[model samples]
Target: MILEQAILNIKPEESIVFEKAFAEAQKIISSMPGFVNLDLLKCIEETDKYLLLVKWESIEDHTIGFRQSEKYNEWKQLLHHFYDPFPVVEHYETVISI
Candidate 1:
């Protein structure tokens, strides 16, 4: 499995709205091909910060399949504007898991 992670810095005071929007946006991603699952985490110290983790079958499933699909546009519309400076997404493969 491929793990996709992004550190999202939402606009100040917009966390609540962002979370609500994400609830709807999650449906879009969950329906995509190669999607395994996802988790959205909020930071205790920084209320405006969030961590989005998604599991996919392969990198191409995200980079090509999702990003290049029309559904990505919907995803972007629903949640991208909440990001302050935009998030940098990275992918990982598990080296060890217990």
Candidate 2:
């Protein structure tokens, strides 16, 4: 599996709206091919920060499958605006799991 991670820095005072938008947008992502699951977590120390973790069957499932699809436009409209400077997303493969 491939792990997608991002530290979302939301614009000041926009957390609530962002959360609602993300809740709506996640439905789009969940319907994509190769999507496994997702987790969105709020940072305890940073009120406007969120951590997004998504599992996919492969990196192409995200980079090409999702990003290249028309659904991405809807997803972007919903959640992209709330980002401060925009989040940097990265992918990883498991090194170890016990």
Candidate 3:
């Protein structure tokens, strides 16, 4: 599985609205192909920061399958505006697990 990670820095005081928008946006991503699961974690030290982790079957599943699909526009529309400078997304493969 490929793990997609992004550190989202929401606009000041917009976390609540972002969360609500994400609630709807999550449904869009969850319905896509190769989607395993996702978690949205809020930071304790920085309330405006959030960690988004999504598991996919392959990198293509997210880069091509999802990003290239029309659904991506919906996802962007719902949650993109909440970001300040925008987030950097990265993908990883597990090396070791207990």
Candidate 4:
């Protein structure tokens, strides 16, 4: 599995709005090929910050398949504007797990 991680810095007081948008966006991504699951996390110290972890069958399924699809545009439209500066996204593979 491939894990895609992003630290989203949302605008002040936009958590509720972003959460709603994320719920909608989740449905879209979940329907895509190779999608395994998604998790949205919030920072206790920073209310405006969130972490998005998405699991995919492979990197290509997310980087190439999802990004190139029309649904990505819709996803961006729903949630991208909430970010002050776009978050940086990174990918990882599991090394060890208990």
Q: Return the clash pairs for model 1, or none.
A: none
Task: Give the per-residue lDDT digits (tens) of candidate 2, residues 5-97.
Answer: 999999999999999999899999999999999999999999999999999999999999999999999999999999988899999999999
Off by over 4 Å in 4: none
Cα RMSD of all models vs. native, in order, equals 0.5, 0.5, 0.4, 0.7
Model 1: per-residue Cα lDDT over 9-91, one tens digit each? 99999999999999999999999999999999999999899999999999999999999999999999999999988999999
Model 1 TM-score relative to the real fold: 0.98
Question: Total clashing residue pairs per candidate?
Answer: 0, 0, 0, 0
Among all windows of 10 consecutive residues in model 3, the one with the lowest summed lDDT is 79-88
Residue 65 error, candidate 3, Å: 0.3
Question: In model 3, where do residues sit more than 4 Å from their true spots?
Answer: none
Better of 2 and 3 by lDDT: 3
Models sorted by TM-score, best on top: 3, 2, 1, 4
Q: Local distance difference test, per candidate?
A: 0.97, 0.97, 0.98, 0.96
Candidate 2 versus the native: TM-score? Answer: 0.98
lDDT of 1: 0.97
TM-score of each: 0.98, 0.98, 0.99, 0.97
